[model samples]
Target: GVLAQAIPARSHPPSARSPRMFAWPEKRGIASTVIRSADTWQARSPLIPHEAFRWLHSELRLALENFDPSVPGQEWQGKAMSEWLREYYLESIHHHHDAEEDVYNPWLAALGAEVPPSIASDHRELVATIEVCLGLAKSLVGGDASAASSLKRELAGMMDVLEVHFDMEDEYYSRVLVDFNVTQAEEGAAVGRINQDMGLEGCRVLLPMVVYAMYAWGGPEVVEQFKGNVPPPVWATLESDWLDDFFCNNLRVIRRLQGRAEPELAEGA
Candidate 1:
């Protein structure tokens, strides 16, 4: 059985006296520990983050198509396209890349993982583009029904960047984390680092976004698996306001785009 411990606050040589800490945290601490094998990590592909990438890109495509045909449905069902981009799209991805840098990059680098330089460059370019679009989205307040073709074209460009970036990221994760035999403890640290950085405030939006993405692309089993990997409290939202406010409303825009039925918790995801 693996002896679990906290993630080290700083790196140290993996000597018997000083080594990297890797454990799933619990209320009483690492006193009673149980760790799954790499098989648990291997059961998934591109890991949890990549799952969100797939679903979010799918959502982006839906958004772009809906907006392309004249931006008609602004008021009835859910958020306006621009509003969704401002609140969710721009921020969600921006934070995702940031977390990868702050959380995953150090650990992966230490593990001798080979990451392509392009992924980091893609993240920077994508965030800059998204920030500019965020400002445009802000101006188009109320998901402005009269949004111009120029804005729509901006979204198309965003979708192009987003879609290509997703494939690149997925490839990177598969090559680095998946085939490289990342330990369950290491994976646990990655999850732990993500949860810690997101904190409760960030989780209010970001966690639900992850849950929604998992629910949409991966289904119930997949969503449950994803939920289990993170801190349990993130999903334990009182009344699930996170889902209704952060996830469902934006998802409704996608449904409205397709002329589909309004969202339930199921649809919201």
Candidate 2:
């Protein structure tokens, strides 16, 4: 419900209506459609694009820690975490795919019919993998550690699948950027560019929010690898007001579930 509402249909409004000229290109007694590029006008926004990973990462880490032997809440906690994983599955990952489907796929399809089809097929495959993960999630909730572990093993198998998926996406984006001269715009350069480029921004934004979200959900090394990119001022800002808002508003939910609170901040927030 909350997740359903979280992903709005349009992050930004389109510039104009469809034109008959672009819609139906003419050849010698033949007609074709010219699919315009999926202009990522809102896609490149600062806060929202990164927010999904942040939310999912935090939630999933809490779920994993729920599996900890020392964790107090037991099956009850596991059940709650299971619900969260499912919510995140539907919200973060699924919603993201929908964006690709609606925007990226159509544009790529315009490039060639096969392109979108191949890309669309991956959605189904990912759904299948998620189904397996869901089964593991259920077992974990039911207190079936063995079953859950088996599912996790299978889920781990999909890591290669997922990585390849991301790789394909990166390739797709790279190609699109080249087409549009938007490689620089595709990713915000000059701002945390080094960390992301060299993979060092992790060190720059090492607050609990960044750590559990980017590192834990994605991978520890994803952030650890980015150890230097976060500029001092950015880090200072994150440490202060941004962090202050995150914890002040959300710490209780995370803490009650055995997550570390905002006990440590790099400096301020």
Candidate 3:
């Protein structure tokens, strides 16, 4: 009913007066489409992304603790710490905002929804914060001990902005999707397209970051949801390689600092 109302039926020639509309792309391949229809389709679950963000928030806090100068045996040095923050910023936060700006918001606008300008403004602010942190991080790369304290402060500020930005995004966009009755299949397709556009190399770096963060924080449901959407070949690569020793090692370090037990690195049958 919502789809029919939002999008008029196909006609001989597209009407000049017809409402601009959005639909899931049909070109991603039949297998993906079928999987989405059979396995992924459902009512929108806004909490999944929200949970992932919360996990990221927690991970950053843990990282900052490791970076603290007052802490005995500082676990993270300038270069390694900087790289970690860069990876999270680029693969997670930046990509997430870019997807909303380029795909999600535009799609809603085409569907005649009034997408809020504040969301874009929030992204800009977040980007500025990220850049500031990154610059501080770069300065730290030469083992500047003094920069550690400043880097930690910058990270804390970034976290503050992220908390508010994520809440706003979840409130507005998630509600819009639910209100419009956007199928999970459609949402999956949109996400799939965004990943595809990133190319294989980009996926190599980003996919694991996303999977690790979501799995570590969002629990089993989020893990299964993401795994189900991944094709078998890609899923195999993620398990066998991308999320291999390095990811597990990082997980171990983070968990140790937080006084948590080591989680099973791989999902079991």
The C-alpha lDDT values of all candidates are: 0.56, 0.44, 0.58
Q: List model 1 lDDT by residue over 1-269, tens digit each.
A: 01112222222222221111111111121110121111344445443555455556666666566554333444432246666666666777788888777777767887888667887888888788877777667656554444545566776787677667766665566556666788777777776767676555555556565555544445566656666665434444512345545434555566676566655432222
Ranking by TM-score: 3, 1, 2
Q: Report the Cα lDDT for residue 186, model 2.
A: 34
Task: State the lDDT at 56 in candidate 2.
Answer: 40
- Candidate 3 lDDT score at position 221: 62
Best by lDDT: 3
How much does each candidate deviate from the true structure in C-alpha RMSD? 12.7, 16.9, 14.2
Model 3 alpha-carbon miss at residue 151, Å: 1.6
Once fitted onto the true fold, the runs of candidate 2 whose alpha carbons sit more than 4 angstroms away are 1-77, 111-118, 180-263, 266-269
